[model samples]
Target: MAFLGFESKVFMAPMAGITDAPWRTILAACGAGNLISEMAAINAIQRKNPKSWQIANVKDEPYPVVVQLVGNNPELFADAAKLVTDLGAYSIDINMGCPVKKIVNNHAGSALMCDLPLAAQIIEATIKATPLKVSVKFRKGWDNEHINAVEFAKMCENSGASYITVHGRTRAQGYAGVADWNIIGEVKSAVKIPVVGNGDIDSPQKAEQMLQQYEVDGVMLGRAMLGNPWLLHRTHHYLQTGEILSEPNASQIRQMLLKHLHLLVNYYGEHSGMAISRKHIGWYVKSMYDAKRFREQYTKLNTLSAAQDLINEYFLRIEA
Candidate 1:
């Protein structure tokens, strides 16, 4: 069953530098949920920044793309909503859950949680700007001392948001401490719009736990998904079949790493692709034999062919 035009209820939470076009294409291969682009600043979109536009681009993607925008200006958000709608986004997600210092210093991202009236105005402006569904992603609250997930969720719904996603941590938490899933439930109980829970959902079991325990409509997989592209497919399969699929073996991991590298090369050209592939290469080799030593050597590589040769030899030695 489709949730918001996606094949599954699970969602890929947007992460800067990681959920680019090449990564999404790889993560969508075996199974998929709603795929979100990295958050693009509304200011950049309005200024017609090419890098920002490329981050939000989904023209050739085969699946529905949810473009997440971050900013506090209502007028700019309205203008951005219009631009993404024209660019063919399936929906626009307002980013009120980001806890980055630069974003918060600008009164955007999770910082909007502290200013309810302004947040409402931004949501309302974007809703009126386009025909596409508009959702808002936010945290539990500005902090523990000012818990307001329920209030925040209600504000979004009242302002005409299509749905809401709660990243069960407060802005003050900044990815530390356990995510308070109960706050997500509180938001769910307070709103008529569908609620999706985010944060600390690293495995399929955790994703299902959010759905069944908190009664959230869906779950968003975050940072834990960095090197593990198959996580979306694995979680989706577990939800539908109640089966625990095995993690990819070394050989299979190699195949995916190469596949991702190839996509980055084709999409961004080999020069940039090889440089970008290093981080993923580190992730893909996690827990493999001699991984620490291999990573040291791989980092010195500057070309795709060099990386490929190293990977082939390293994985073969592991298999042997």
Candidate 2:
């Protein structure tokens, strides 16, 4: 099945606050399937918020960028779709997968899963507003007791969703426990629309396994790609050659981390970017030599220079 008119089959999931422009560019460069921008708030966009507009813009991105929007109001969601499509997104995705309190309390996000009819309304309205292809990312249901991915996938297809992404956990699960791939397979079986399976795809082997076992149209990698952009390239290579790609050495990992920090600094400025990089710093240093000590020191670093120094020192110790 074609995605946003492209034949590519892998996607970097629209991870809120994580899949930024730099991340999209790096993943696209490494042969990631069509890139998905992080989710933008429909309410923020409808209010003409500057931050929301910037977050949705993707005109200069290298790969086909599919913009994801989150909101409860059908009309507002439709308007946001038009706005992002105007900004040159190849497609627009509705976020019915987020389980955050702010979004769910507003009847947006995975809360829509609790009401499939309204979820269909949102999809219908968004599809009518823009010529760009539309997709929806949703959880199994509000909880295990309310599992309805099959029913929800059908509703999305009937309402004109061009594709569907099923995150196997429910709203109540919230990244806890193992993702039940069986639910994702069930959703794929229930829908004629292209189904992309997401959740727990942390390694290239797991990616290939998901593709082989579920027969999904695509695999979307989320949290696993953090501080590991090479996963995109490695997964793509393994898919094509049937051989596992070697993992990056500690030095290589450190370099990637530094590159990411530089890009983030360029995109968000030093102060804001450094704060954001802290989360990634923690991820990159894990399991490496002196990682715990480096993490402790890095957490206290407020300047880019200090962070760079700490990284250099940590790697130096590893080499020594």
Candidate 3:
């Protein structure tokens, strides 16, 4: 259950556009057990795509970072695994759980769930290519009609995957409906290696529930951590003390948002950083009063100063 030397069992999921180096560094400081990089396309990496390199960058993280790669080609996966390892990745995670249409159509991601033999071959190739521990993240199945997580977990374990993570839904379900924790439990029962449960776990209580009820070795959070890195800290604290902490107040949330903006600007440069900050800004104000108007105003931001000014104005209005 050791997660490449992480101290906690609450992990940040490898969300494609969200869990980049800047955000991972923030979560690590908040005591996230493990921080995974955004999904890196293996073909893009092999082609020396600059955007792929940017997303895969893990240089500043304090903890050993886990880089997740998505692709169906075994040779390309092997090559990408080695590249990330050379760039200082602590582990390589195969992306069999991504449900995006583009990825699935490419015969990658959740599509791999339909072809267990190829998935196993990819795992074996990546493991053989790198001395780093390799893992696989997959869904319950391709659809409700094909519930093969238990069988897939066994294949990954037998194929030399160090551990496995299972999202509770199938590809057909996408992010809709409730994630079936019972299926995660089934995978846990079917595998001897560590099993991490992902999906629908957004709070400390939910995290504890997954561990106590589903018996997973760990829990991975994705959408839940979008603008609430404090959830990671709160989950860890609750696990240690059996007491839930108060949610971050308006002031605290504002400060976190400001810090997030600064980090994004530092990492991605001002223009692109401000562009990317739009969605995060919206997430931060999602629960606030008149948030729709604020979001409409925020997405028009084209400069860092303009974004900062708008954020200050928004917080002032909340305080008023």
Candidate 4:
């Protein structure tokens, strides 16, 4: 991320269905340098998947956004890149790291790891088709049977990708065990393009550790920032000033959740908006006292007003 000359080091990884415009816009305000949209299926985009179409909209996005696309076929993947570039993405990211059954079974995602030549071809086609900058996200390899991130990073660089992001886990590892920062360090050493290190970065200290230990250009946070966009700003501050910032208090957390709800309603209409808002609110309250009670009450909220009223009541009690 920083190697892309990003002013901020904290970046939000693309999470399907969860990292939409409303969420990206919110994260952007919290000092996230980049926002990556969830991976859109190449077939879906080529066939004009209405759901994918809605998710790819970058018209009113707050800052430079990179849309990630995934598929096995080089032709379809190339077409999808062209489509998103026409939609005004700041950049395009190819997904070679997804380990899902559908994605892998289709010979895409981590499946591409089995064939480096084909993976290189996909990168070539993507670079040829789009005017936008190209980047790649991938696991170390299909498994320990073939760990070749350094060579793969070279392939991406040869194909004209601006950068590479390594997750530091083999496809076999899934999200299971620890991410080998040493592997990320290896990939960084092997490539001229910037390497963005992403794995289980849960806090600013861990982010600093990634920079110091791995020598990566930047860090990407996926699940760790679930209900805490403030992590981005805190991470940026820690990197620059070497100081830790206080976590948001209950009242402030409530306010941020409410602001998110408002954005969701503005973006996705009220009925569906309130329903989706509950999930995020649930994540926010999970670490608080009486979390079970909060989730139980919050789930029953069918309207925005009902949910906001309950949230206000909960925060008032804490503030008092």
Lowest summed lDDT window (length 10), candidate 1: 1-10
Model 1, range 217-284, lDDT digits (tens) per residue? Answer: 99999888878888888998999999988998889988998899999888889888888888988888
Best by lDDT: 1
TM-score of each: 0.97, 0.95, 0.96, 0.95
Candidate 2: lDDT of 51?
74
Top candidate on TM-score is 1
- Residue 225, candidate 3: Cα error in Å is 1.3
Clashes of 1: 0
Taken over the whole model, the C-alpha lDDT of each candidate is: 0.90, 0.85, 0.88, 0.86
142-237 in candidate 3: lDDT tens per residue? 898999999999999999999898999999999999999999999999888988899999999999999999888899887898888888878878
User: What would the per-residue lDDT of candidate 4 be over residues 1-320, giving only the tens digit for each residue?
Assistant: 36565666767888886888888877877764577887889889888888887777686775888899898888987899889998878889999999888889999998888888999899999999998889999988878988988888888899888988899899999989988888899999988888899999999999999999888888998888888888878888898889898999887898899999999998889988888887888788888878789889888878888888998888888777
Query: What ranges in model 3 sit over 4 Å off?
Result: 1-4
Q: Score candidate 4 by lDDT.
A: 0.86
